[model samples]
Target: MSDLKLTRRQSLVLGAGALFALGTRGAFSQDATTLTFWSVRLNTPELQAALLPILAQFEAEHPGIKVVNEPVSGNLVYPKFLTAVQGQLMPDVAEAYSYHPLQFAALGQMAEMDDLIKSWETSGRLKDVVNEFAYKKFFWNDHYWGVPYNLDPRAIYYRKDLLEAKGIKPPTNWDEFQAAAIALNDPANGVYGLSFPAGNFHITQHFFMGFMFQAGGSILDKDGNLVFGTTARDANIRALTYLTDFATKHKVTPEGIGSWDTPDAHTFFQQGRAAFGMGTGVLIGEIQRGNPDLIDKIGILETLQGPAAKLTAGFFNPMFVWNYSPAKEAAMTFVDWFTQPGRLEPLYAANPGGLWPIFKSEFDSELTRSQPLMQEMLAKVIPYTTDFAYPGTGVPEMGVIDGEKMFAAPVNEVVIGQKTPAQAIDDAQAKMAALWEE
Candidate 1:
């Protein structure tokens, strides 16, 4: 997700104080059952072209239902969501961030989805076909709150051609990953082994979480208690030190990464300034557009193996309904129509590897088979993909940790030489623990 540059407090004010301004959009229908759909993907022209037709078709098929598309910026959606919920003006259906559904459900703002899932003709397939681990994250408070639609799991993307030229096999573990980075590092030529953000942004938090999981550490345990400071302290410190070393000790990643965001890091790989980087399937499409010639030369690793474990974390974009929506049934009807088999072809076709298949049936579909790059990439990374709240159910506190950019604070301090890894970890633990208590 791109940075919105809005602090959590700023978003709270927007949600609380600016709600009256939001109601003036004049998009909602008066005579028909209107379902206001909010989506982050709708911000892009390609996605808009793909969805507008389908929404139009839906309105044509359903007699009295009107569908309105409201494109929300990815980073700002959570704040807008909070305001909408507080003001009782929530969109009928929304594309929630990976952790938003859990948090909103905890606040009693999201509608339960198990009953809706049960009513589908492909209910059995829908339950069985999607990635089971990603599916279960929505099962909070003994009920499901959201439906998983898109999977954007993170993986290490490397330049296969560059590795072959240097005779370096793809790195499977952190030791090998760093060794490869050092081997490939040529700063005088403006090339680095890795491109990562260290700035206090959500992308940095995302990268940190991947390494934390890789080191067999987690913020919370299965019981949803703070474990980062207690049980996972050593692993957490090791993970932080390893990632920060890219800029500080090794000097293999770009300098001033402390000021970079997602696009900055991605541009390094897109422009061939970095030999290896970590990102989601979105990288595939962006790389295709930014540098078409480098397309086939890129390869994806399942995830780099750490000393303790080898899994990765990423977004499992889920669609959720608002409990207070008057058009709840109409909203769900649109969701059902949207998720039906072969219905998602336009999105898949518009951006081949940008959005992943949430249904197992989509795997063997001709559209998927047509794109060998997506097939090879998805096959490698999807198996190892899991949500951000590893080992623990996603609690509301986890969302705050991510939204407020807590993970990046300690990381930035370490990168800038303000504190050692242990000290930074101690500070982060105290701050997060206090938040949890609140």
Candidate 2:
């Protein structure tokens, strides 16, 4: 009360007499048990409707802690994240898109979770938890940064009837894939072998990385150096080659397809003009609502393999902590409770659709014969699945420039015949060197 305030060193969430005077930007910790959270994802009604109650329940149970869900999405959040960190005003817990944490990790803004994970590991709870994707992505460099909360795999959706009618089996290799694409493509008849969203980096980056990995290439090696060389470089070339052939060479995907993003692919598939589309496995439910009859005719396959095809990435809204957060321990306890398998089981069921779960424990023996379609995905008739993680560009601005403009666009340009693979690489290489290098 006498100009004395709480410090995180003493306890999380200063209370009672503790107070904060905003706008002056002085460091002051409260002694209360309240936690502040921020996220880049717009505070959509759906998310609020789903999660607010969870927070309320948590708070109700822990009378000592008060949880506040701050709306920081849209223009309010992304820019503020950097500012807040500088001001030491970051939230106790926040929601962030797939790779957003990576930027925070680089800045040392994220709190470490080694102790939480170690505890969870020894506890039977971690063993019962099934989401391995979340587990793997949480650990960055050498420590835990974020916890994957909700992630869905990207699966190729094709018109099974079209493929079967044309005697085209799903292509296994790049050559076969292109040939089949050529066969199913009838652009003149308003049918695209495949359709793509042009500007959305999330989708485009995922697809390109898929090809790169299948070709046995990686965006970065273990040391974080960009993977480049004949194996890696040619893998990039191969990805560009097939991508371009769809519209540029074979003329299957419409030139218009390149202008639209994933939603475009969704529309194309729904309208039946595109024979193949890549989208979130969760989209299967939406598909059922529109094309109710063709539901069974839709073919689902694990993301196509690269030379290292089984390696793919999944995007997630991860739970992150702020370094300056005074209530990290309480926040982490909530994270642990939220991701617990029993908790996740209901979350998974809330959306009954095609998405494959990220946790191994999420799927149990009871699900073996849950349903035919789910069975196929679980059986993974193809015998392999790949996963993706945070790309180097985790910040919003960096994703737009480095991943979208610098990485994916050039490769797309080659696919569209605007640049030769070599030229495309040179262009991308120059941009990447200039940007990523110190």
Candidate 3:
């Protein structure tokens, strides 16, 4: 593996270099056609047990092809991939964040998948495909570059037992959510209303974007222009004010949230220190590992409504074949096989509430039916889910905007009282615009 530590300037330089790298002609194993795959699932016994067997089956069915699953952490996927690109050591296939394929595609490092998808549609296999939002995440520059692996929507997870004890129903909209958090918040007893990151991390950006969308504001309009501080200024201001109020005015979240990231928020929630936590189904798996007893007491809510709209950021972390792969057809075959319901169900069951199905019909599968909680979550989240490129198809600059912490900085400023929401938004807009102007 390549060294994971690289500066943002280095990453950009490597990204530009990827456009010139030639393809590797053969598999890492000379004896067989092996597909080197990078998976986002952590390298754990349970995940391996669920994933390896499916690869074995694919190998058995194909007779001459082998699939290797290399587990990588979610945060490191993009950087490691960029390193691979710079070295011309790209994997045959890899899973990445929802925004990454577009970046890779724009750099000419990712293979276009339109033909393979068309083949599936022609063969009537497209019915099992994920919904439009998931598919659209990888669609940019008039081509499809990735396949949706799972649906990652920003849903709320609350302490069911705690809410019940307080005689509160699960909140559905922003007002109800804030009220519930305030009413149940007891800082003296080490219980707060909400647990979410406000740090200079992508998790913070995700949360901030969700609120902005819920308030009917978008980062870019349909023409791919920055609008947060222009056309959608008021909605973004409202969104920022509400988000910071949790830490400043409402005083419901834990102290020093501006310094907290995903792990901090996860630990705070797992210890039963908060009444509400915001994340994807991944939170369920985290709680199950850190505090199994809390599992039965947890309730997942749909993306809450705001004054302007009912919307949340949906992440369709997709799998894409590197353009440098010699065996493109073989890689797609494995990609298609691994995403089938039968193969996906075992992985889902093994993780137990961690992975949500990208295919809409899988919600009614026996696996989902057996787990009542998953069924409830999918039903609610699907309706409110929108891609990070809301109100537009998607743009390559969107990845840069997210990677550079352009959105989180503004929210951090407002929360820390260094600037008003309007000032923060304006400064962020100026900084972001300056990036593309170069």
Candidate 4:
């Protein structure tokens, strides 16, 4: 099939027209339900090939439903989704980052899956298979709004040979982490102890949040209220101070890390310029392609422990049913079928690490157990993993804050030594409060 290309503006216009036509035509056909699926992952060749076949299989089994697959560019997905929501032209099934559906759920734009999920025969099995952390992140207002799709868990990737050669053991806590970093630093040899991104990007936000969580604090409270400036101030400051100190005080990370993005840090590790780096499993693939020799020397560890907790960041892009869609039942059917281990294993195999399973059954399957690396990675992450918004405080506006980089700017200021960690945290909290008020 030829690609269905639609610019952002054109998508909005066409979406609105489609809504009008649907309304004027009255109810959909009685015999067949045609469900439109909008997904950003389809932009990739591997994902497209893996998903298209599964969708076709779904159509074959359920002859009464037709699936219309639409691929949207990652950068344009949120904006176009907003436009569709405003125009009442939402797709029947849509893929979204965890926070995106929360935004829609707040507005009652997302369909609640609690009833459907509970009534399904596989509900008990699903609960058993899926990591509670993975599914719970989608819970809001006491209802499940999204189906867990994939997991991206962050861990520390270190040079096994370098550490062994230095007679240094892997770090488990902050002090040991710092000591190891300092010991591993060799500026004359063009090696840094650690590599991290400090730019105003998603990577920066992610790692920063992991640090904050490890420090036993979060930007928002469990009640979804802004707490960074008041209740969580000290913990937030401590986390930020520790991160900035890597460059400003410890001097173990690269000199210009305050301006580096994800690629910069990843490249530093890939080229053997850094002994330790923090990232998702995808980094393994990039290393295999760019520095194949380093593959055997790489070792993974859970994020280091802090005074209060040991935590790391995990990301999920979920599949949700839009409330405005006429084929909500059909969309749920597809989601239910898609998440089953039998159907999902192939998709996971097509893109290892990139689509880590959220289900325990899948985790225990031969497909996962066959690869010890994947198994070890999952074991290290699942227990301590959390979403970007922290665990229980994912409010609608958090999505807006993340998208606009409201949290990143202040963090960047601290990293560059333009502001103290305390000051930056206070400023970020104030800015976030304004957003919540608005």
lDDT of 1 at 50: 93
Better of 1 and 4 by TM-score: 4
Scanning candidate 3 in windows of ten residues, the lowest lDDT window is: 1-10
Q: Pick out the ten consecutive residues of candidate 4 with the lowest summed lDDT.
A: 17-26
TM-score of each: 0.88, 0.80, 0.89, 0.89
Better of 1 and 2 by lDDT: 1
Clashes of each: 0, 27, 0, 1
Q: Which parts of model 2 have CA positions greater than 4 angstroms off?
A: 1-32, 39-42, 71-77, 86-88, 124-133, 228-231, 345-357, 364-405
Tens digits of per-residue lDDT for model 1, 281-303: 67777876677787788888757
Clashes (candidate 2)? 27
Which residue pairs in candidate 4 have backbone atoms (N, alpha carbon, C) closer than 3 angstroms, thus clashing? 129-360
Model 4 earns a TM-score of 0.89
For 1-438, candidate 2 gives per-residue lDDT tens digits of 122343431111111123332222212245447777664452655545655777787787777667777766644544676556445576777777665565566545577877777877798655654445455555656887777665555656778889999888877666777777778888788888887664535567666666666766655554444544323577777766766667677777777655666677777787888788766655665665566787778776645645555555455557777665657677887777766654544334444453334455666535435544455555542234433432332322233233234566765666545778767766766654443433
* Stretches > 4 Å off in candidate 4: 1-27, 120-122, 370-372, 391-393
Candidate 4 per-residue lDDT over residues 1-438, each given as its tens digit: 122343333332222222221211112587898888887754577778888988899999999998888888978977787677655577888776667777767655678988655754355655654456566667777888886777777777888899999999988888898889999999899989998888888678778888889898787776767787789889888888887788888888887877887778888888888888876677765765566777678878756789889887777668888776777777888888877666677666766666777766667777566654566677776667777666564666677667767667766898787898888888888777765542
Predicted structure 1, TM vs. truth: 0.88
- Candidate 1 Cα RMSD after full superposition onto the native fold (Å): 5.1
Candidate 1: list runs displaced more than 4 Å.
1-31, 119-122, 126-129
